[model samples]
Target: MIDIFLVPIALVVVLVMLHAWFGVGILKRGIIFTDLAIAQFAALGSAISLGYFHEEYFYILTLSFALLSAFLIAIASQREIKLEAFIGLLYVLGASGIMMVLSHSAEGMEHFKSLLASDILFTSPNDLYKSAIIYAFIALALWKILPKTKGFVRELLFFSLLALTVTSSVQLAGVLVVFVLLIAPAFVAISLELKKPLLYSFFFGWFFSIVAIIASYYFDLPTGYSIVFLGALLSSTIVLFSSKKNSAQN
Candidate 1:
């Protein structure tokens, strides 16, 4: 039983570490839905692959779409238009594209649900290994290369790396899982004004993820949904109590 969970747990740990860092950047940039949009595009690409080509080179298609979305967003960020609105449009476009692509398929609904919240409990070892490698490379770029860039170049690199991360993560977890992991813990850490926000975010994310995984095993709940539920629950509780504390102080 313990052995069975080792791989999944390891995968979640890696996800928390990398995602928490990216979450900090996203929160700071105030582009909260960026990950969701990118993940949706990635899923749309996968849906296209499955609906038409039967899953051949699905990752390549997904990564390509994600990168394209990233590039568009990067360019748009330099303009004076409402960037959030543009991101929202991209999200809707990707979502509707996925539906249209999968409309005639018998497994459309199942594929849609999997894209939203995958069965991480059954993730293959190969997927986990590939995801780890991708995340590690992104982490290295963020730590070394990102800090040296400025303005448009920095924004482009950031979004490009984020898109790649979302592409891999959506395959391992799901779009909803990726969004929650990218936002909730980071939100909580920022709300509480932690000095080491990224470290705290990692702890919060890891704790909830582990709890959700164990709860899913005992309750037969969907692992991805369970993680999202627990993450939202914890973050909301923190926000509620923190607001109350502030009100009392005032």
Candidate 2:
């Protein structure tokens, strides 16, 4: 009795919200590639699970690995090494390992496809519940840690957020959408001069994603592609309109 179309849309809303929040946090730390790398690592984790573990445990294993990867990224961010380099290293290593793992298994294609992009239509309420629980944990953990954590602790908080970001991104875009989820709304928020960029980005990303979800459902288009396109469009429109308004004020 569930409306399947609404499923993906609602899922996208939750995902975009988490993505925007974590995206902003990552940008604040000046680590553009961090989330993407962590996401790929998470995908690698999922591939391993699908290859070896019971199918029932695939998501749990994926999430755990993603959280662990996030912790690693946070630790790396605290180091003196340039973040992009560290991210590059992580992505390459994770991706290569995933490929190797998949190669050894009969379900390689399924895992590969899931890593490349997941079909949100197939996601069930149980999947949503699991995602919600993990996201809430990450959010609550971040809330507790961000304010209290000094230098390294702050990085840890961001790291937890990054892990959550990877989970959302993998579910929504597989591995590809991670960067878009991380960067687009953050880009929009930066141009707005908002008092609370984080909140603004969350709203904007969520709204934009929901719009795309609806659009895709109505038009029979690809949900992920539609969301990304709309997100980019809205971001561009906002930046352009803001610049024009500023110019007019001057």
lDDT to native, each model: 0.92, 0.74
**Consecutive 10-residue window with the lowest summed lDDT within model 1:** 241-250
lDDT of 1: 0.92
lDDT by residue for model 2 (1-250), tens? 2487566666766776777777776677677777777888888777877777745677677778888877887787667888788888888988898988889787797768667656565568777877778777777876775777777777776776777657655865677655666678887887777888878887777777677766676787766666667777778887888864557668
Question: Over the full model, what C-alpha lDDT does candidate 2 score relative to the true structure?
Answer: 0.74
Residue-level lDDT tens digits of model 1 in 107-161 = 9989999999987887788888888888888999998999999999999999999
| TM-score quality measure for candidate 1 | 0.96
Cα lDDT, model 2, residue 11: 72
lDDT of 1 at 211: 92
